[model samples]
Structure formats: C-alpha cells, structure tokens
Target: MAGEVPAAAAAASATLLALELAWSPSTLTDADIEVLVVQGLLLEKAISGWRSYFGEASPSEDWTATVVFRSFYEKGFGLPSGAFFWGLLHYYGLEATHLKPNSITQIATFIHLCKGFLGIAPHFNLWRALYHLRAYPSKGTPDVVGGAAFSLHRGGKYPEAIFKDSNKRWAEEWFVVANPTPGLLPRTGLPPVVNARWEEKPTEEEMVEVQVLLAELQKHKAEKLTGATVALSFAKWLTQPI
Candidate 1:
C-alpha cells in the first residue's frame, strides 16, 4: 500500500470489534436474528474503517467501497445506505434503518430525518456557516453547506442531469423546473424504468415527500462520478443533503 496504514490504528480497530463480539453484545435484543443483524453491521463498519485507513489502491476505490458497505448494510445486515443522507437527516433517524419505505428508500429517509429533527433549522444559510466555520472552506463544501459538491450531480455547472439516478433523471427533467418543498414532485412523462422486471412504477403518493436536490459542481462543468473528488462529493452529499 502506498499510503501505508499504521499498525496501531489497525490493532485498535480489531480490539474494539473483538471486545464487542466477545461479550455477546446482542444481549439487549433477545432475538437471535436481531443480534446477528446488528453484529453484521458492526463487522461491516469495522472492515470498511480498516480498508479506508489503508492506502488508496482501487482506481474506483470509493465506488467499490460503497458497494461493499451497501451490500453489508443493505443485503448482509439488511441495512440501507441512507438512513440519514447528508446534513438534512437527523442522527436519531439512523435507528430507523430498518423502515424500508416504497421505492425511493433514500428519499423516504430524507423526509423522516427532516421531520424528526424538529428544530435547529440550520437557518438554511449554508454560505454564511462556511465562512464562519474557518478562515477557509473545504474544496467540496466551498462557501456554502448545500453547494454543488453536496449536490447529487456532484460536479458540473449547468447540471448534465445524466450521471444521477435514471429514475431521478425522469424526476429531474420535471424537478428542476418545478417548485419543490423537500417533497416529491408529481410524475409526468414516462417513468424511468418500469415493466415486469421492475414490477411497477413508483406512484406519486408513494414518493410524495422524496426530495430531489441536485447542484452544480465546482471544478468540472460536465458532471462526472468516476474520481476521488466525486466520491468525496458523494460523501458530502450523503452526510448533508441539499
């Protein structure tokens, strides 16, 4: 590994997991399946933490890591990646990772977090906060909390509207033009992907509160999701919804 992760960090992570595993940590929940599920989530986090601590090897390291994490959280431990996407969703909402809503799992998550948070409405003024946050803002965050980097588009000035979710593309064609209120916009035109394979198209009510937040990127005009900064943008997007 070029970056060379220190042995100390690895050892510490291993010990933490070992301690949790040894004590039958699942005792709080009597159900074996529940215990197993939580244990699996913890294990997934430990492994990812270890991998991140190491060097950047995979060209698409972050993308691959995303798949690994999602698989463990969504499939393995039965968790979804966005219990709380970005800054909009509340921390308490993380507990409801199990509540899988209709099709837009991430969107439902955003709504839940917004409603649950119940205060500290960030003044919705990200620009000012960034200025005060420090003498300078990070590259992605820039001078605003909900800037382009936090956008799903990740990069690009005019918003290519391609690199985002296909279904979202259909949503966006209409979304950008309409007035949104942290909720889903009604459907128009054909849905992105539907048929026997997808089973059905997501209904308007089904995705009513699912918000669509896309912004322009700083560095590149045409959005691209194949780089480190893109992944960092995604992290920023996930941690703090715009």
Candidate 2:
C-alpha cells in the first residue's frame, strides 16, 4: 500500500505537469519537458511526505506562501516583476482595477498564476501600490516601475498585430531576438536595456505584504481542508467574473 501510494502520486504529478506544459507560453524541447516532469515528481513526493508527517498540524498558510514567494525570488532569472506583471495583465485581460487587496482569494489566485504560469516572482507590495489597492493611486503603469529585462518595441517595429496573429511563435521569436548575442538581430533591433537583476532580494515590505495576504486567505477558509482544496477553491474563484 505504501509503495503504491508513491507510484500513484508520481503518476498524478506527471499528468499535471504534462497538462500545464501544453498551455506554457514558451515552447519546450523534449529534454526540458522530461527534466520538468522529474522535478515535479520529486517536489510532489517531498511535499506529500512532509504533509503526512505533520498530519493535522501542517504549516500555516502564511509560512507556505512566504517560502514559495521567497524561493521564486531567489531562483527566478528570466523576466523581471514588472514585465511579468504586464504580460499577466495583457494575457488575462485584467486591468489594475480588478486587483483588490481585500479580494483575498482572487489575489492569491493571481499570485499563483504569476509564479506558476508566468514563471516570475510576484512583487506583492509593488503591485498593490501600483494598482492603488490600499490608497496608493488610481492609475499606474508597469513601465514606471523599471527593472524590466526587455520592453515591447514601439511604432511599427514588432507591431501588436504581428504578435496578436502569431500565437506562441511570437514568444519563441522574442526569446531568440532577445538573446544578447544573436547571430543576426531582427530589424527592430535588441531590447534597449537588459537590467537582469539576478541577485535582487525581496524587501521587508514585500515579505510583510505576503504575510498579510496569506493571513487573509487563512481567515477566508471555512474549514480545515488540505492545501489542495484551498488551491482548488482559488482556481474556481478565478473562473468567476470579477
């Protein structure tokens, strides 16, 4: 029974990874996909074992969110927070007005989407202030925050129409063009700046905000369900109109 449990969990993890990769914005090679599957399986086993050992007294939601956000901040290397935020908003057709701090479940959903799907660290405090969640501002643009690894080109260069029609191919092309030492630069040229803050660390304010958000989520939970149930609730909440 114990051995079968591990095998079943591994199979489930692989299935989930496959489903997620199908919707990934960037195309991944077979080798990369295999690597992700292996990693996902390992993560699943570790988390499952840890939860089993803890049993009814698992870590608090705030602790889990903090660790997850901090790990992403430490490891993420591609897109900066602002660029990822821009892409997330554009892809989801979400405006700044939709991101309310008090909407704990929705906010948690966005955090998960930003990290899991967008492959970027969620800058909680920055986003909250940018969207004026807690009396920050009525309207603010992501461009003003800076630290972007690349920016969308202006004018007819890399027109929105091209990307709109191109699908994932455009994402692939952007990566190829964005390469610092591409053999041949596109007609639009490379991104103007490449401030890849690989060593950047999370600020105290950001960690505090994460704690606050998780605490709110904890309060919103009506029962003592597993993290998976909470995650499912967040996912369902995402489908409803704002």
Best candidate per lDDT, number? Answer: 2
lDDT of 1 by residue, 113-211 (tens): 233332222222221111111111333322211111222322322223222332311111100111113322232211121113111223455333221
lDDT of each: 0.25, 0.30
Candidate 2, residues 52-122, lDDT tens digits: the string is 11112111222122101111211221111244444443433333222222222333444554454334466
Model 1 scores a TM of 0.18
Residue pairs in steric clash, candidate 1?
73-79, 86-238, 86-239, 86-240, 87-239, 87-240, 87-241, 156-217, 156-221, 184-208
Judge candidate 1 at residue 121 and give its lDDT. 28
- Which residue pairs show backbone clashes in model 2? none
